[model samples]
Target chain A: MDPVLLLDVILLLLAVTTAITAMAIRDLLGSVMLMGIYGLLMAVIWADLFAMDVSFTEASVGAGAATILLLSALTRTGTRERTGGDHHLPALVVVLITGSVLIHGTSQMPAFGDPQAPAHIHVAPHYLSQDIGKVSQKSSDGATRRDFGDHVPNTVTAVLTAYRGYDTMFETVVIFSAGVCLVLLLRPRSPLRREQADE
Target chain B: MNIDGHLIAALLVLIGAILSMIRAAAGPTSYDRVLAVNVFGTKAVMLLAIIGFIGDRSGFLDIAILYGLVNFIATVALLRFVETKRLT
Candidate 1:
């Protein structure tokens, strides 16, 4: 097997193992730590796939912010999980069904990195061609005026900011709202206030 | 088969990561698990840097740096959480 592909397979298998163990473990602290390992594995996988932007996001958000947030939550709640009856059978059946359906859905999709894929045949070519800096802006009378200087070379950034501006805007809004909610929920208690109340 | 040096390096780092994962999953002590996770993060940073070389893209190094910083912060947070019951 190709080494890069082997690396991908190993990382993915490790991720699945950590994920399942995280769910099955009785110790909540261990489970959370396993989740941290899983996040790092996923970030590596994304980097291996050459999706650096996504890898960066996973590194910062998945392995960083998420682990800190979960640890804080665990601080409030005890690290030991309460014993619950084993009811794995039903969940296993549901997971199997969902996995099969998703796998079946993949059959109709293009192969990995297929240059002739529909996505590549459409506006993607136009967007990629913009790297040449040939993009021209039209004046009020519909005549091409000045060349749009140095069209963004990074296709991912261009797509996020230019082609799909509204989508990216909404995503930022969602993230901002999530941060606001976290601040409201997890803000530190004022030590002076508590001391005064005790007095 | 022609083997790339960078791939070999990445594979080695990946092996280290898998071992760390094992320790993280089944470690007897919470500190052991925490250390395992931190080790895994370091391995991940190394893997990313190696793969960046293989791909000939400088952008992967940016991600490697991000992972490195995050790993440090997360390890400190986990250690603090273990030492003290509260994050504050």
Candidate 2:
């Protein structure tokens, strides 16, 4: 196997182990912290997949802000998880079914970086050819254009801002709405709720 | 396939993360687990830097830097929340 592939597999294995351990742990705080580690590992995997924009988002928001939120919530809630319940059989079956379904779903998708895959065959070619800043290649007959090297080299930024502007706009709106929702729900209104007595 | 300095360094950092994970899972005190996770986050920053270099994308460095700053801030936030039981 390629070293890069080896690294990817190792990272993924670590992520899986951490996630399972997080779920199994009795201490809620430890589980949340492990989740933070899992987020970072997932960010690394996204970077390895060449989705730098997604990776950046994962690193900053998923791993960073989310961890703080979980920790703060933990402070409000007690850290000790209530010990195990009696019904493990149904839950185990559900988890197993979910895991298999997810794996099966991913198996049907094109392997990573397969250039001729459907997604690559689609809008990707358009993004590759249409350079706002510079013309990449002109046909010998001067009719067809292909190359667009002089463009906004970071096409992810360009595409997100230009072609998929609405999606990005809505995404921003969603994040802003989350903040508004948090403030609405969390900002203490009554004085009694203000001073939380330790349970 | 071939082992070299970059690959070795990345592997080492990951091993460190694994050890941190063990410590975080087994620590008697929540604080110890928190500290272990912080160390893991720091290792994650280094791994990101190495992975960025391996992939020839400088943008990975940007994520690594963000992780460094965010990880520190998160740790501090956790400590404050744990100590005071409320976030002002």
Predicted structure with the largest TM-score when compared to the true one = 1
Kindly report the docking quality category of candidate 1: medium
DockQ of each: 0.78, 0.67
Alpha-carbon error at A121 in model 1, in Å? 7.2
What is the lDDT of every predicted structure here? Answer: 0.83, 0.82
Across all candidates, the chain A TM-score values are 0.70, 0.68
lDDT of 2: 0.82
TM per candidate: 0.78, 0.78
lDDT of 2 by residue, A153-173 (tens): 675755764668788789899
Model 1 lDDT per residue over B22-63, tens place: 888889998999899889888888888787777677887888
Tell me, by lDDT, which candidate is best: 1
Clashing pairs in 2: A136-A147, A136-A148
